[model samples]
Target: MTIKNQYGIVKIAIASGKGGTGKTTLATNLAAYLSGKQKIILADLDVEEPNSGLFIRVERKHEEIMYKMIPGWEEDKCTFCGLCQEVCNFNAVLNMGKLILVYPELCHSCYACSELCPEGALPMKKQRMGVLKHFSNGKINFIESKLDIGQEQAVPLIAQTLDYVDKHSENESLVILDSPPGTSCPVIEATKEADKILLVTEPTPFGLHDLKLAVETMEKLDKEFVVVLNRYGVGNAGVEEYCKENDIRIIAMIPDDRQVAELYARGKLVYKKSSAFREALDRIAEYILEN
Candidate 1:
């Protein structure tokens, strides 16, 4: 069932307002299901802790270290002008009379301090932040980026991963982004350019609360999005009611099945074993193609 759409390179982002809501489950299984029909690229943009590759079996095609630009202080070229510290909004640069310090964790890569330095003492340098790996199993191409253990930021790595996808993917192939869990900067960077976003959530009070936050964020970004309720048979109807009140569409509801959990625990995909799960994936794929 290759999708024939007028839009080139349809990008669908699967995200959640909070963690542990079956976001990766949907992403991995959907990619697996779609790969049976046409070529697809599944990108795990949750660089802080990407786990989509756990459920997938792929051979590594390429790997590279990811870096972010940060100002490096050179004392030999400094005259203690204090310009670098004054221009740094993130407090990444500090002048202590005789010495200067640059914090790579705090730097946002705006290059303000380095670019405006009169003596050119602060030079923009590449600082290791993460690593990106590309893998493939014929039809399914998987890209995963993992942030360094002590890295403080994730947006830079997420941005670079998307750039890699843009360069490698064909205009007609489908690209599914497994975004980070939250409405923060990393999530925004992952989904901002997506053609459509599927916000996954469980049907609980906590899920409803975070779903509201995610919904508000999509509204602010003016993005076209829908909701998917996971573990649907156990929780209350708060998610359904809220979606109805807000006129938000509930695209699919995956039932709470213990068999699904058992397979997931073994790092196995459920679409091949669970008919219910495959039905949900069919609906999701149909929605993506129709819209």
Candidate 2:
């Protein structure tokens, strides 16, 4: 099948500038709303702290151990030259007189140490970072990445998960991806071939500022996108005015409600409980379809 037809199923990515902006909340509810209405894949690309599973409660169907490259010290070939430490940008290795100490948490798996180790004292080893979990809730496919606590880079995990989705979704489905916070590499990887990018932001100054950065990033990627005003009453009205002035479409607006907060605290998808939010989510789905 052609990629255009494969992708014509509609891929929507919901992302934000920073964390705690209700990005996942919006993504999850939207996925829930589109659950039976269409063939949908709900992907949570927040590898570091993916919380979509907590709300969706889907039965995990497939999981794989995620791995990354780390330095393996070879004691026999050790020159104790300390060049590895010098070239190591993450400070993961420290050589102290006949002993090589490795702080795994400090390593970025950049392979600079092994490359610069003249004595070949360092080798690359695969280390488990986390798991790529796949689940199914009714007709919706749920995918999530949970990075190991100390593992810093989530880009690889996100890339691998997206690859999994692309490979596994051969049947064609409306893929709605929940991207990680910040317009960083992980977010970029998640939203990479997306048909529509939804920037979810609040009304606060930080929200507006970060949204602008995210919007700029999407514009550079040359992807079709729109904005979703989340937590509509947190701060100034500048985001709305900015969207209007910039000719950016406001696809949906979710008002800040204590009940929503309560549902979130209880780890639940709002569409499961609140009819209003469900209706709003349906409208968001309709907007996505119309656009």
Candidate 3:
């Protein structure tokens, strides 16, 4: 299934409109389906709250602290000029009468303040954002990041997660990214370099509504993507209708089954119990190869 130009590596991002929409389920299953036959790595980029490993259970191979650069002020230079605060576009730097404050949460690490400082009063300092873990069950490698609880910004941590994947990505293999929900900056960062994205949504009004928003986000990124209608039987007809009207292809429709839900709740995968899901995932692999 390797294309001549493709290094046999496929980067597929599975994202949803909002949380609790089964993005990780589809991502892990897809990676599980490709195990043994192809080199596959599953990355959980939902740094704020990651749970992909609760099911796969790979032995943790490595872990690292992910950090971002924040400005550090030098009071010894003797100046309360507030130049750093004035240059910061994110409002991360604030100056008081004699105290210079650098809010790490609001900083984007652009280094603009340090670059523009006259006396080099500001130097970039590292702040811990999260921890990244690496593991492998022989065939599928897993990497996930967990943002420090109460951490407000996730983009820096998400970058570290992807950086690990990019640095450790297996040659001639596939990378399946489980992105955080919503059309925010973190989600955008996850989907940036993906060759194709699988947008998973249900058949309800909320599903359709957020699906559209996600679709717009993908279009803005100019990346090719397809839709996955999960729990197809329970929701309304809007999912299919919207796909038809928008010329979007429906790659797979997973039925709402008590068995699957129960297995998921127990941290079990469907392929361990049902052959149908395995077959469906094989079909999805073929769809990715074809398109």
Candidate 4:
């Protein structure tokens, strides 16, 4: 189904509150299945270590340098009043006893140092945090952001990757974003403005707890979401009960299939081998189309 929202694109984010919960497995397979019928791309926003690319072989289309501006010390403009240090919550700016040290690697690029710099001593400098890579293999379009080593912030790269998708896929039908795990700033950036969010979760207690956190985040962001219960038979019924009690929709359940796991271990798409996984994704895709 070619679903389009106000942005002229259907942005569906596949996310999980905890890692190893099968978000990449769901996103890649869903995108691959949908790509046959629609103009779609799978964006791997887990820049810290993007593994979705390993599942699919894609020809490199292009690359763009994603940069973030951070504070740069200007010794000429003096006056280290410690305001920059006080304002920084990330501890990026360390007002040394003599030399005011500015660690761009540690900085979140919040501009607290530059904005509050009374002396304008710390000017903004361009720091290459990552590169957004675009790939295409006939019908399958893929995009992923790779963060440079020592770069602490991932939200900027995620935003850049989404911007790349928008610039190229404005007329396309769907953009499935593989969001980073946890309800953190990076996850927030990845899920923002998504037409629908498919939360991947398991049946364990930890899974349910983190799913609750993810549900809270979705509620706080006022985004519509449904839970995809991965490894359905492995854990307790807590997640299902919580979803039922909270009135959350459990869209699809991908059973604990050894075939799926074996295919995944081989760096293959589990849906391609297992009928159960394919059926699960088909149900979720139909739900998206219907809704």
Summarize candidate 4's per-residue lDDT along 109-176 as a digit string, tens digits: 88878988899988889988998888998777899999999888888888888888887785756889
| Better candidate by TM-score, 1 or 2 | 1
lDDT of 3 by residue, 13-43 (tens): 9999888778888888788767768778899
**Whole-model lDDT, model 3:** 0.85
What's the lDDT for all of these models?
0.92, 0.82, 0.85, 0.87
By lDDT, is 2 or 4 better? 4
Looking at model 4, residue 31 earns an lDDT score of 82
Better of 1 and 4 by TM-score: 1
Give the residue spans of candidate 2 off by over 4 A.
Answer: 1-9, 233-236, 272-275
Q: Estimate each model's TM-score.
A: 0.97, 0.86, 0.94, 0.92
Which numbered prediction scores highest in lDDT against the true structure?
Answer: 1
Error of 1 at 177 (Å): 0.4
TM-score of candidate 1 versus the correct structure, residues matched by position: 0.97
Worst 10 residues of 4 by lDDT: 1-10
Superior candidate under lDDT, 3 versus 4: 4
Model 1 has an lDDT value of 0.92
lDDT string for model 1 (1-291, tens) is: 676467568899999999989999999999999998888999999999999999989999999999999988888999999988899898988999999988888889999998899999988999999899999988999999999898889999999999999998875789999999999999999999998999999899999999999999999999999999999898899999999999999989999999888888899999899888998998898889875
RMSD of 2: 3.1
Q: Candidate 2 local accuracy as lDDT?
A: 0.82
Q: After superposition, how far is residue 58 of candidate 2 from its true place, in Å?
A: 1.9
Tens digits of per-residue lDDT, candidate 2, 120-209, equal 788888888889989986677899889888778788788878888887674558788999998878888888888888888988888889
Supply every candidate's count of residue pairs whose N, Cα or C atoms clash at under 3 angstroms: 0, 0, 0, 0
